[model samples]
Target: MKLVQKWTVFMLGLLVVSFGIVLTIRAELGVAPWDVFHIGLSNQFSFTVGRAGQVTGFVIILLSFVVGKIKPTLGTIANILLIGFMIDLLMLVVSSPTNLIIRYFYLILGTVIFGFGAGLYISAHCGTGPRDSLMMALDKNLSYDISIIRGGIEVGALSIGYILGGPVGIGTILIALGIGPIVGLSLNKVNQLKNKLQPKIDCYN
Candidate 1:
């Protein structure tokens, strides 16, 4: 695929991801570890969650580059700049539901959508966001198991976020347990779709 096309996909996927994130937030049940951190920062600083996320992403990018020697790619830069803004924008319109069933629906739907969005962006072959970059760096530098590294990072984030007054509940546990399998499934589907489309794309090219 062309560079522009790849960027288009990346941006679109980020938009979808942001929408999904907003849905989860609106559900008011809880959020992912990184999101908990973002929300905590927002609450502490009196800023939007998106702004908090942007600042966090910027810091992580710097740490990844300086400490881990991981260069930020175009996609990485875009991911930092775009997703947070989109999330804040979405939040302006997406209000939390008062009904219990509806809130759970939002949480579940958001999780699936988030997973699909992740798959789409990953399949674009641009680059990963700051958090993933950090994970890779830690895995490489620490010589630890990747799962252990990831779990450590997330648990640390979760702890800090909770201390900072972020919400924690069943939704957090649900996301933690369910997101991996959902993302795996979404990636498989995205790959299959990409494979099927490749021949058509080649013909057009």
Candidate 2:
């Protein structure tokens, strides 16, 4: 890829995160499971989720590093900024949904957008997001199946969110279930894209 195109992809990743933020606030159904926890923490402690995400990412990245995992890279930076950007977008422009239907639709939108963004940035082979990091940690430490482990993560996070004063409703449950399929679809596309790019990169080398 040309320098210009690579730069474009990087910038697009940021936009995708910003878009996710808007969808989240507009969804107003409450944040997705992990985000619900972050938001709840933020609300209770008077910190924004984005800032919390960054701090969480820093800790997770350090832990992963200590484990001899992938070193930090631009995707790591993106993960940090993405949530921060979302928080800023939330504070600046987006508003809560007015009704249940709109709220649900907003969550669906947020899921798709967030999944797509995560797919793209993750495909960069840089680093996983903070939430993804937490999920992987659970999967590793508990030696559980991905589905079961992820389910536990969501259930645990949502419960924490509930305790922390985040909204929990049908949407919370829906998002927990819905995010997996949507993200799987998005990541499949990203994997295909990565496969297609590999030969070109290999050729250049």
Measured over all alpha carbons after superposition, the RMSD of each candidate to the real structure, in angstroms, is 1.9, 3.8
TM-score of 1: 0.95
* Model 2 lDDT per residue over 1-205, tens place: 5545544555565578557756865677666766777777788886776776666668766775655454666666676776586666566676776888877777778767876775665445555665566566555666678888667866887788779877666656665676667667876886776678767752111
lDDT of 1: 0.86
Stretches of model 2 off by over 4 angstroms after superposition: 1-7, 63-74, 135-142, 190-205
Whole-model lDDT, model 2: 0.66
Worst 10 residues of 2 by lDDT: 196-205
Error of 2 at 114 (Å): 1.9
Off by over 4 Å in 1: 202-205
Sliding window of 10 residues with minimal summed lDDT for model 1? 196-205
Best by lDDT: 1
* lDDT digits (tens) for residues 163-185 of candidate 1: 89888887899889988898889
